[model samples]
Target: MIEKKITLVPIGDIDDSLLEYISQSIKTTFNLNTHLIPCQDLIGCVPEPVFGGRYNSTTLLKQFHECLPGKIFKLVAITDLDLYSPIFSCFFGEAQLGGCCALISLHRLGQEYYGLVEDKALFLSRCEKEVIHEISHLFGLLHCSDNNCIMYPSNNIIDTDVKSSSFCPSCNSLIERALV
Candidate 1:
């Protein structure tokens, strides 16, 4: 059997610290070996921004799916660019349900994006939540009804803030089974 592991791909100039934090967070959260590959260029892969300089997340996710490495059990690409889908104005991240690829954007996670003073702790917390949420989808988990669960959908930053970084009991059980 192929060893299950997660590979984080930095799709542009994301901070080294943020990438490291994400790698460690995924490792701890999923109990999976996680590592980061060298930075990748998404310039030609993604099309031009359509809605208010935000790239279509579905398109990006498709690109990720096409290029995902066979040996990597899961792959999460981190980008600083803004992302949006046809169904939503913008989103923190997107993933292929039951697939190996996921994508996240750090653009709106930072407080400075809302014109507030930068809070490193808050930003990092949001990052972790969003990353974990997307990765959960890769494990065939759907959005949870529990508002406080990490699997609960985040309509806005406030929703994300209100939710816990960990899954609810039901989701926890589901993920445990999926991991096995």
Candidate 2:
């Protein structure tokens, strides 16, 4: 069997530091090895210009699927553009939900997006939470009711900020089982 791992795919010009930070967090959180594929590897995954420039999250997810590594691995594609799914107007991220691919957008994670001053620290925190939430779903975990859990859906920035980056106890247990 192929070793299970997590691979970070950048949809475009993403900061290396940010990707490294998220990679480290994923390693520590799920106790799985993480790989960072440079931006060039995913430039092809960048969707063609959409009507308003907002890429369809599902389309990007499919693109990422084509680039998945041969080994059993979870692919998390990060981007700076806004993203939307057919089901929602716009979402922080979208996942195949128990499949091998997921996508997260950094567009809405920063304070500046809301007309506030830019907060890099807070933006990184929010990005980390979204990454964890989406990966957990790829592991077959669903949304949680606990408001403070990372798995809880964030309807707005406040919802994202209110939640902890760590998973709730039950969600953690589910993750543990999935790992096994």
What's the lDDT for all of these models? 0.86, 0.85
CA lDDT for candidate 1: 0.86
Clashes of 1: 0
Candidate 1 lDDT, tens digit per residue, 1-180?
A: 767888888876888899889888988999888877754432335457887898889888887666655566888888888988886544899988999888889999999999999999999999999999999999999999899999999889999999999999999999999999
Error of 1 at 132 (Å): 0.7
Output the worst ten-in-a-row residue range by lDDT, candidate 1: 38-47
Scanning candidate 2 in windows of ten residues, the lowest lDDT window is 38-47
Clashing residue pairs for model 1:
none
Position 52, candidate 1: lDDT: 89
RMSD of 1: 1.8
lDDT of 2 by residue, 1-180 (tens): 766888887876898899889988898899888887765665455477574877888887887777555564788889888887877544799998899988899999989889999999999999999999999999999989999998999878899999999888999899999988
List residue ranges in candidate 1 displaced over 4 A.
39-46, 88-90
